[model samples]
Target: EPEVTQTPSHQVTQMGQEVILRCVPISNHLYFYWYRQILGQKVEFLVSFYNNEISEKSEIFDDQFSVERPDGSNFTLKIRSTKLEDSAMYFCASSRTGNSGNTIYFGEGSWLTVV
Candidate 1:
């Protein structure tokens, strides 16, 4: 079965730099999401995209964060002016639908470290 795949499995950046994490979600899925887990924290939802626009977003998805489906297949998460607290394992996920009964598939995650 197809699964979400992320690029640059690990990344380290300066405190004020920008970071872009790339992902290719399962091809047939319609709803895409971005979630993150700080080293010792729970997985937190950041944003969800559908129909090429943000469908929902959590407070953690502040102005510094952005998501884009630049191509028909690739999904991306960008963190601007990164901070130490922004370091985490960012997961790319997708599901056929947004309904509760749908199964959400997640990528292994792209680890980000900000100095």
Candidate 2:
């Protein structure tokens, strides 16, 4: 079995600063995604990447946000500018299939805190 792993388990940043959350998904998986959960809030989808491009994205993934697979082995999400409302536990995930009925697995998560 394989799993997604995220780095810098926790981070705190200034309101206008940028932050990049990193992740390494299961090697064989083809679909990777970024999701987040604000404290006391439900988890929400951010973006999904496949075949080296964005396959899907939620409205929450605005110009201020971007994602990339810098290398064949790792995936990353960059927040152009942090906002107090951006504080949340960001999760990296992967799936063998991206079908609606299929399941996607998640990493432990990277907690982002903004002031």
Candidate 3:
């Protein structure tokens, strides 16, 4: 089975700094998403992209955050002016379709620590 992959498994950055997390989702998947878990908190959806546009985004996905599919296989998430509250395990996920029943494969996760 194919799996999502991420780069820089862990990172430490100071507050107000910019951070970019990279991912390569399952090649055949059509829907891509970004989710974050702040330490012990439940996983929270940030945004979803499809057909080269944003399909949906949660409140947590503010101006400070951006997503891009820079190429055929690369998906990236950039956080501008990071804050302590932004620290979390960022998961990149993808599914063949947006249907709720479809399985969404997730990357191991990129851990971000804001100082």
How large is the C-alpha RMSD of every model relative to the true structure?
0.6, 1.0, 0.7
Pull out the clashing pairs in model 3: none
Give the top-scoring candidate (TM-score).
1
lDDT computed for candidate 3: 0.96
Candidate 3 wrongly placed segments (more than 4 Å): none
Q: What tens-digit string does per-residue lDDT give for candidate 2 at 1-115?
A: 6789999899999999999999999888889999999999999999999999999999999999999999999999999878999999999999988888777889999999999
Better of 1 and 3 by TM-score: 1
lDDT of 2 at 107: 99
* Candidate 3 local lDDT, residue 39: 95
Candidate 3, residue 34: Cα displacement in angstroms equals 0.2
Candidate 3 lands at a TM-score of 0.97
Full-model lDDT, candidate 2: 0.94
- Report the C-alpha lDDT of model 3 over 18-95, residue by residue, as the tens digit: 999999999999999999999999999999999999999999999999999999999999999999999999999999
Candidate order (lDDT): 1, 3, 2
Which parts of model 1 are misplaced by more than 4 Å?
A: none
